[model samples]
Target chain A: MRGIRIGVCLLGLALALGAQDQANIVITGSRKYQMAVPDFNALPGVAPDVRATFDQVLWNDLYESAVVNLVGRSLYTAPAPQSEADLDSAGFRQAWSEPPLNVQRLVFGSMQVNNGGLVVDGYLYDVTQPPGGGRLLARRYADPATTAGARAIAHEFADDIIAALGFGPGIATSQIAFISNRTGHQEVWTMDYDGHNQRQRTNLHSIAYSPRISPDGTKLAFMSSVSGEPQIKLLSLLTNRLLPFPTYKGMAETPAWSPDGKKLAFAADMGGPNIEIYTINVNGTDLKRLTHSHGYDNFAPAWNPKPPPGSPGQIAFVSSRIGLPQIYIMNADGSDQQRLPLGGYAVSPSWSPNGLALAFAWVRTGGGEDSGASDIYLWYFGQQKYVQLTHNEERNDFPSWAPDGRHIVFESGAPYRTQLFTVAADGSVPEQLTSQGSNEMPNWSWH
Target chain B: MKQSTSRYFLTAVTAGSALLFSLGLAGCGHKAVPPPPVPAPAAKPTPAPTVTLSADPTSIESGSSSTLTWTSSNAVKVELNGAAVDLNGNQSVSPTQSTDYQVVATGADGQTANDSVRISVTQPPPPPPPPPAVQPAPSFAESVRDAFFDFDKSDIRPDAQQALDTDAAYLKSNPNVDVEVVGHCDARGSAEYNLALGHRRADAVKNYLVSQGVDASRITTESVGKEDPFCTETTSECYQQNRRGHFVRGQ
Candidate 1:
């Protein structure tokens, strides 16, 4: 009897552990959590088309998150469970009769139009838990019954679901600003996180490069050769107003806004013969020179979004003082400078939001006869090492990190054209984002 | 008495000339006094164009100005050093070293004449205070052996010391000459970081020179990073050659 009781207790503990999914997600593995997203059931007042649109947008959002390997409805031999009552009645175990539909998680939702607004209710069920009930998370969102609003509502729920799965947050709401020569000149353009609803931001009618969105997302700073020389320009997204940043002597390129949004640091040929790092306030006051190098050109300053404790001020930038260009870290006031132990040509660094790592374009050609092509690399500050995030493919450059610190949007091209591409932080799944025209210098907006 | 004698002589000559004229008119055999013999037509010769060239000061210190004045006569055109000029005018010319100004004049008959003036430019005399012991001027690029560093290092290398030593020795002798130490890097690494690294390399050379009896004030350092490489070839030797601290004499 004692032996039987002990065995029963061990089995019960094992079942409990299995039911509880891991809350902390380590994104560096190949084991993907299988997820199923079915068309949302339309209530009487809701048009079936609206419900279909909601389901489609939500499914795409979850699928593009890159972590969830979705199972399509074609794999299911039986009809999908639409409502909570239906799911409860049929039991979660009967939701899918097909072998592949037995996913770890199942997403089912319902949509309806009520009082001129769209209401969406979504649920995530850990199907491995129990036979009758397997609900892990649920959320309800309402918005005006418009296409854009409905899509936004779905994205909100998807973001919440992603957050519950230990991912930082979904980037569905963020936008990427990049330079595109679609209209005969390189202008700053912004598109939704998934490359939808692209709109031109700056009509400078001139070549623009390196669009940096403010942390608050109200202002955009970019370098434009509009005034016949490259100068930093700030645009107020709220008012559609554009103003030139008061600069000293030479041209300014590569503007990066600080995490606090009070200052803008950029690479400009000012106060010296060569390009050096300078910071100016958003209101065009308090100009400060962060570097005093009169010889070697220093630029591409990326302010750490999250500096380590006791060092609230830290910046990573590219410097060629040694021989080739290498990444260097300095304090906010340009002190305590140290080189990141990376070799070869590294430039255009974009710091991750979490400040644990930086993404940059690097080529490891040791000045031999080989002209090494560039690819994206991630230098993990915590690990004090680098990982080549791209392979020996086309030339890649100008990496920008998404707010979630998971996706990096960069530019890749070979012969006559280049386009924007987004890859997971782990260097997997490089998805081309832009194709119509030559695009370069992609910057992810702050959420 | 002289006036009376001249009046009487004029009257007697007038009567004789009248009798002669009457006799000639009456068909008497008499020789008519011929008018003074007409002078043969004199030939007018074409005048050759004459040119005058002069320099106010034939010899001057280098970079000093001199006045060159020239006048040409009977000339339709005048040119100074292949450039047309006024027939008579003065021009101020500063010959850097020594130069010759030639003036050519063409007369109306297509005849040409030329003259030249030379201005010798000499170095300014040494100061009254006897010059210091003569020493060769420093060769900026040659005197600095490029203060080469190891891969990705800004520290001066042992092999590069000879050049820096020569630079320091020259700098010590010529205390007034200031030099600029420009740092360079190979075409690799982050351009911004390479700039900072290049700065450190130039600073390293400057510091070393200062330590070796060269005045710190005589050295200013800058870095071109990898933007301006000495050698663009992809060879290791080229990269090593590019990673250097070049020397430049400052004004």
Candidate 2:
């Protein structure tokens, strides 16, 4: 009887080990971890403006990451932690009060005015920890008491929290170059990635579009129609001077920079009435024709951000050779061309940084092209399946990827009232980046 | 200890069954992986525009001329690289060398087609014995006239044809003079579009002169678009006067 009991116990242990395979607790699909960010508490002598600015800016930056699901403040049933000292108090127990609220993490901070300057203390805690200790991240920033300085401090702190949580280096420090018509003509205007510090970069006083910032982020290349031809022009950020590229006889537009930044590929009418993809040296030498579509317009060339193994290079471009516009991938030298398995009026192909997927604007067609509205879609090369990122909203086009690879900026509008907007790569939490005037063709900076 | 053993046994049994059920539900274990298809070459869905070019006289004297006409039904716009003519019009071309004029037509559907017409200008049958008398001096200034266009149209208006005819006559009378037709547009729409419209306007003037029996080589064209408006004042009358093709003599 003793031997039988021992045998049963051993059998139970083996079965339990087999059943508790951690991977078996499978989620249907991956999702953002629920995170709660309560408003930062103000120190006894701190001004309300300082507290409000820091809290709002930090929340905006963190929420823009899209990897974390921010919990609403109304659900918080605990007292707000005022300072780092409060972490030692029982009053801060609310940070980990989880159950009814399924938040997995808590973000709280405090701000105070010291010597006419604002000082902020930021913290992030894991809700799964016990009340005594759950500090996952903590940082402090000091800045002049100006509103802009306060906002900058908050952005820096939010970046710290994101990096600590391993969500990739944050995009808060990046900038976006977009075409805006605020000065009565379409010119290149740049602003902080979150839509602050907007200033005009080009005053061509003519129409310009497709502003692509170089990898070094010092120069901008765009297609301007000021010289009576749709020609590619470059603007120096250091000097604010506009330099025209070597003149091609026909119209030139849609300038794309190669990953190495040594070459610019654009659509030119060099061969025929319809444009073809052509690559020219940055100094405008060694012009090479990449496509011969037999008079079918092949424009909008987007070089792959990362090249695959055993190939010179690869590019994702939109070609209208099949009667309808579709995304096509080809070697950089224009060989081994094949179309993506998509059927629609698709254009504006932007390759993801990892080269695993392509984000493009697609207007679904039902035997005819004019009926459907344009929306952004992601085509996963690995899965060979696509998911629509935007649905039945305003027409969203020109989906350019952010440097972090987790976000995309695109133009959204009907016709005359277009604005720039940024969204997560998986298509969530779209934040309007520009609203003052008509903005379009936003290209995220490489850094 | 005995109770703990019973509880462990119960939990193990439940978890083991759940694992087995999930594995069974997964079937072949990969719902997301589908058979990959070999990429094939893209299908060519449609052909480019079809064009035809024919020279009216097919041959001309060394200094004389012949008309070259083209017809393209599928195309919305046609371009003669060096010569300016409408989508379906004729131009009297007198090439010093035997010249082949290629016309490319771009359809509204974005397909292009091209054709060429060669005009054989005969080598002047051994330079005719010269007439000993002196020729009259080249005349200008009075014959150079401004031609107007309709709102945005580049075609020569019925009223503007008279001025163009006078300019054509002056060029015919003085074969030694070569002129440039400068095109302009009013301040409206996009600058680039205006530039293109301006070029078309100048080209239309050159084509009209060529059809009126002026040597095509003697007329060059340029478009300043809305940049060099003849009238800078912001008024409807000024804009109307600015939309014109001006004639200028080469130095």
Candidate 3:
């Protein structure tokens, strides 16, 4: 009798382990986990427009996450659960987990207006769990009762859902800093990742461009002509004012922040013969020159988010030291410089979040009929091969990697009227994010 | 006495006869010594006067005057518009209405030659108002020229040298005026590298100006990369125009 009991116990343990493995497959497998998000219930006193905004933003956020395959609304057999009580209904689980709507997860919630503010009760359920469904997440988000407020709540809820599903962090809440001439000057502007809440952040009334947001998103370092010359200017986003920075002779441009947010690596001539790379502390001290080549131009420094073992970090920059502008990587202190073997002209190197690959603009054949068109290419450190992301398009340049490392934002169009666009890392689903005026130089937030 | 009378009568008769014969021959001989050939009264000796009337400007704007001139030859008197005037003269006339100016020249034989010119006049247009104030001098951009470069090159070209020379001359002439050199590039190539290339172009321009005896401190450099283009067309000429080192007056 004891042996039978032990055998049964072992069998039960083995079955449980197999089920857990299945769950693991659902979380981290090659195939995308399917999810369904029905409309969130709007309680009394909730404006229709606010509810609509919330629903649309939430759906778009999930769709653009590119992690889960959202089941179309047409396949939804049962209405969305209005509250937590609806999760106890077997029909809800059966309708979502059965064929024609075979989604493993469901995100349903309720929104209301409380004290002139928006309140959202969001929930995520694993519909594949037996006995109705297992609840994975429950949270309440509140903000001002406006469309923007609703959008913010939706973004937060979508990010929460993405995190609960085992995807690292969603980029729904991140912002993209870009240059826009909509205000008649190339001022620094920012927008949500899905192209909402576009707000101009500068009024220099002069030509200001090449905005690089600090890693913490608290400061912005950009090139501006407010002082009648192109100099690096820093602005505190939290204060909406200019921060004091020392001005150098000659032209300073393309300021990139280090990963730790303690230093800025930029290109400047500083009355020198050629433009070279330099690093300075965030407080505007400890100026160190990186490249020392004479008469050979170097600029456009991008720092790797993660450096290899036993190294402070690596910086990828563009240099004409070898005659044509090519992408080169070196230690943060500007030592051990090595050029990637990309034959044609390559510039604008943006390191991916993983620090294993670089996205840059490349002209595969230089100085011929094919030289005029440049495409974005990704070079992987592990593979040592380039994968072309854009093909035969207009002048595409200034590629910035998204925080998720799954998408890249870049500028493409005629030189005079370029606009910002984002595409999946695999060169899929290219979407234009800006259409007003000429927008360019999109720097995605580090977060 | 009878015999003497008879002889005297005969003599008288003879003498009378002789005298009569002599008278009749004298009359025939004197019949006509034609008045010394009067030369058929040589045809009148009068040449008709030739006159020409013209206006310096046949057409004139209203309120403007045209100079009417007349010239005549072989004319004893000349009349312009029924008023006697010299055979060759000019008069400034502001005609209120369209009028035909006639010049008649009278010759010595009462012969006349005439010429006429028409001057048309319309209502005068309103006068243009005076300029409000003194016009401003040419802007810095107009006074200073931009230096252009070839595709993907920052080295000073021959044409760029001429431009920089002129710019340097301007800078030297105006010591108080500081300037900024902005480098630009065509739409082709990467934007970041273009920024760097633009910087090189601007630095090259500054160095050239400094070498030409202009103070380096008076000049600063900036690169707009391919952001702000002077030319927006896709043609090679437009691209060339876009790739330039522009000059801006410093404050």
lDDT of 2 by residue, A242-292 (tens): 865787785677788898888888877652345688998888799999998
Residue A229, model 1, lDDT: 42
TM-score for candidate 2, residues paired by index: 0.59
Query: Considering DockQ, where higher is better, how would the candidates rank from best to worst?
Result: 3, 1, 2
Candidate 1 stretches with Cα past 4 Å from truth are A1-26, A29-31, A44-52, A94-100, A130-134, A144-146, A366-372, B1-251
> Lowest-scoring 10 consecutive residues by lDDT in candidate 1 chain A?
A1-10
TM-score of chain B of each: 0.45, 0.44, 0.46
Spell out the clash pairs found in candidate 3. Answer: none
Candidate topping DockQ: 3
lDDT values of the candidates? 0.74, 0.73, 0.81
Question: Over 4 Å off in model 3, which ranges?
Answer: A1-30, A367-371, B1-147, B158-182, B206-222, B246-251
lDDT of 3 by residue, B112-147 (tens): 877788888877777798878887756677779999
**Candidate 2, CAPRI quality class derived from DockQ:** incorrect
Ranking by TM-score: 3, 1, 2
Give residue A401's lDDT in candidate 2 (0 to 100): 84
Our model 1 lands, by Cα RMSD against the true structure, at 17.5
Instruction: State every prediction's TM-score relative to the real structure.
Output: 0.60, 0.59, 0.73
Model 1 TM-score on a 0 to 1 scale: 0.60
Task: Please report the candidate that would top lDDT against the real structure.
Answer: 3
